[model samples]
Target: MAIRAAGEHKQRITINIAIDGLRLRDEKTGDCLYHHPVHKISFIAQDMIDSRAFGYIFGSPDTGRRFFGIKTDKAASQVKCREIDM
Candidate 1:
């Protein structure tokens, strides 16, 4: 029997990262199922030490929400939503 770690998601999904936001595209439909804007990307969560970020959170325990069209209350979280000059 193979042992599996908790919170280990092995689903193969296409991820597109652009200047505006990060998107999770459906392989079959070619439709963007999830979108996390660069501004609202609270913090990149790492599952293991020195590992790549597996979670793009919006400064909350809830993952079902947080998107581009969805307006997030910036004042509620510690993150300053001010845009940095590029």
Candidate 2:
């Protein structure tokens, strides 16, 4: 599923569970947003991005953190089932 937040600037993110690991991509330009091999992620942070929504903050500590602005449980479950830290 794509990321959506009401009253916010437009962004396109699609989450996928690949054989190698978790993948986040941009649908409009065919760019990979974030990708991590299974068991390589350092942490998963659950927090509010703004007043409008809450999502995940995940990445290896050495690489810094990245955000995935997911809006629903179903979307989160999709990521979790793939062996993500969250």
Candidate 3:
């Protein structure tokens, strides 16, 4: 396997981002307890933009969970840093 850094890649990296609202239910009661929203962001390396996914970030569904902002910020930064300056 060949390893290439983001800056060394010939093409620009492409990222895929998705957000959705989900209805979570209890297994026993099957009752709709709460509505949760989730965000998923994945990175495709510049070299293998279509062949495979380079990395991914799965955001927490609950905002009350600590470090949510930190995680999201980190993911965003990673994506921004992957871009090659024009």
Candidate 4:
């Protein structure tokens, strides 16, 4: 998880994701389903993090999928939404 300094009034946050790059090799045929990367994977989990409107958002690569949620001030309880595909 990564935290970014967003606004002066509220705190902004972002997430970091890292997937397995190695391919699954077949036992019998010795076939590879996926190929691994030569170098370490480096990518931003969320492209955009804002609190100007309803909440914060992170756009997908194609802009078709989005992951977002609302902001909360209460420490005891918090409200957030799931990833919505648009």
Q: Pick the candidate with the highest TM-score.
A: 2
Model 3, 1-86: lDDT tens per residue? 22254446332222332245334345456666544344333222322332222333334456333211111212344433433211
In model 1, which regions exceed 4 Å deviation? 1-11, 49-53, 59-86
Alpha-carbon TM-score of each model against the true structure: 0.49, 0.50, 0.21, 0.21
As a whole number from 0 to 100, the lDDT of residue 2 in candidate 2 is: 33
Residue pair clashes in candidate 3: none
lDDT of 4 by residue, 25-81 (tens): 444566663343313222212224442223333334564433333343332122222
Off by over 4 Å in 2: 1-7, 42-57, 61-67, 72-75, 84-86
lDDT value, residue 44 of candidate 1? 47
lDDT of 2: 0.57
**Model 3 lDDT vs. the true structure?**
0.33
Clashes of each: 0, 0, 0, 0
Off by over 4 Å in 3: 1-20, 38-86
Error of 3 at 49 (Å): 28
Report the poorest 10 consecutive residues by lDDT, candidate 3.
66-75
Compute the lDDT of residue 24 as modeled in candidate 2.
72
Clashing pairs in 4: none
Clashing pairs in 1: none
